[model samples]
Target chain A: SQQGEEDPQALSIQEGENATMNCSYKTSINNLQWYRQNSGRGLVHLILIRSNEREKHSGRLRVTLDTSKKSSSLLITASRAADTASYFCATGVANSGGYQKVTFGTGTKLQVIP
Target chain B: EAGVAQSPRYKIIEKRQSVAFWCNPISGHATLYWYQQILGQGPKLLIQFQNNGVVDDSQLPKDRFSAERLKGVDSTLKIQPAKLEDSAVYLCASSPPVNSPNEKLFFGSGTQLSVL
Candidate 1:
């Protein structure tokens, strides 16, 4: 079973606009990370936010995590056509043995039209 | 640095046949993972390995699926008597061992398998 679920299964926006995607999870997490996939290919790590952190930024990507609500959101500012891809949120859960395992969300498909 | 590597980018086989896929993790990384991604869905972790030891294989179907990482560098995943439901892309990823709660994962261009 997947621990995280992404909202807005698909989003379409014009180039230069901002795209926002949200993710909700059911379990406690040590951290949450977002990734981008193009055409069902390999995934590229984007950014990660720790449980103690509320927000993080990497270039044009901004991620915010609300542990109290068990949800997170990714915002891509000034989107480009190249930014068209599927976005996923993965949760790292602290296991009983102290190791962490990642569980991915269903993902959001974002299309940035030029 | 070279990213995770996977072989036989594509495969087609009939049901009940056997097939195997290979993955070579980034040099010096200690964590390796295999995930199965069905079309239009998220990737599901099938197994995870730390060095040459198995960390988790609970999601893997033991009856038909098996994997091993020899020498803690390269790994292989095999399926005996494949089923149509097994058609999906197999992704290999590796992460460095770090105390941080989050580790960036490098993924390979997955091998797409089609079982007829």
Candidate 2:
């Protein structure tokens, strides 16, 4: 079963506008990571926010995690057409064996109009 | 470093037929994962391997699916008597270590399978 659910199943925005996607999960997590997938391609790791961290930034992407709410949000500033893709949030659960069990949420599809 | 590599970019087979997909992880990576992604849905973990040892297979359909990592470098996932529902993209990913959420996973292009 999937542990996380993303809001706004689909979004369309014009270039240079910001895009935001939200995700909520059900269990405690070691960390939450966001990934992007282009059409017919595998996923690419975007950014990871640890349970203790509230926010992180990389390039034009910013991610905020609220463990208390079991939710996370990814924001893309000044979105470009190249940013058009599916974004997914995956929750990493630390198992007793010490490995992280990663579960992905239903993704939000973002389309940037040029 | 090179990313994970998957073979047979596309495969087409008839129902009840057998098919196989191969994956080669990055050098020195100890963790490997295989995920099944149906159209319009997030990928689901099918199996995970740590240095040739099975770490997790709970989500794998043992009746028709089997996987093995040979020599802790390359792996193969085989589906026997495939079903129409088995049609999906198979993705391969590898991480340098386990037990760390900070470790980033590198993914392959994946194999698109179509079961008629």
Candidate 3:
């Protein structure tokens, strides 16, 4: 079972436009991570925000986390056509035996039209 | 640094057929994972290995699915009598010991399986 659920099953936008996706989780987590997966490709780690962090940024990507609401959002500014891919939010929970179990969300498919 | 490697980019089989997929994680990584991803859904963890030992396999369907990590470097997952529902992309990911919450995971391209 997935621990997180991403809002907006899919999104489409023109090139140079911004894209925003949201994720919500049910349980407390040690951290939350966002990943990108191109068609027929494996997931690529984008950014990670610790539970204590409220916001994080990487290049044109910005991430915000709200522990109180158990939600997180990812924003890509001036998105390019290459940014088209499926975005997923994974929650990292500290499981027994000193291992971190990261559970993924259903994912948000994004399309950037040129 | 070399990334995780998986073999047989694609596979097609009929019901009840047996098949296996291989994975070689990044060198020196201590943790390895296998996830099954159906189209349009997120990847689901099937098993996890920590240095040749099974850390978790709670989600694995032991009746037909089995995996083994030998010498703590390479792993293989096998399915006997595959079902159509078993068709999905099998992904291999590796990570170093997770002492912190900010650790990153390295993933392979994954094997696309089709069970008819």
Q: Which has the greatest DockQ? A: 3
RMSD of each: 1.5, 1.4, 1.4
TM-score of chain A of 1: 0.96
lDDT of 3 by residue, B21-87 (tens): 9999999887899999999899999999988999889999999999999999999999998999999
Q: What is candidate 2's TM-score for chain A?
A: 0.97
lDDT tens digits, residues A1-114, model 1? 788999999999999999999999998988898999998989999998889999999999999999999999999999999999999999987555445688899999999999
| Pairs with backbone N, CA or C atoms under 3 Å apart (clashes), candidate 2 | none
RMSD of 2: 1.4
How displaced is residue A90 in candidate 3, in Å? 0.5
Return the TM-score for each candidate structure: 0.96, 0.96, 0.96
Q: lDDT for each of the candidates?
A: 0.92, 0.92, 0.92
Candidate 2's docking class is: medium
Candidates sorted by DockQ, best first:
3, 2, 1
The runs of at least 3 residues in candidate 2 whose Cα sits more than 4 Å from the true structure, single-residue gaps closed, are: A96-98, B98-102
Candidate 1 lDDT over B1-116, as tens digits, reads: 88899998999999999999999999988889999999999999999988888999989999999999999999999999899999999999998654444477889999999999
Candidate 3 on A1-114: residue-level lDDT in tens? 999999998999999999999999999998899999999569999999989899999999999999999999999999999999999999987656666788899999999999
| Residues A1-114, model 2: lDDT tens digits | 788899989999999999999999998998898999999579999998889999999999999999999999999999999999999999987666556778899999999999
Q: Model 2 reaches what TM-score against the true structure?
A: 0.96
Clashes of each: 0, 0, 0
Q: What proportion of the real contacts between chains A and B does each prediction keep? A: 0.52, 0.54, 0.60
Native contacts retained by model 3, as a fraction? 0.60
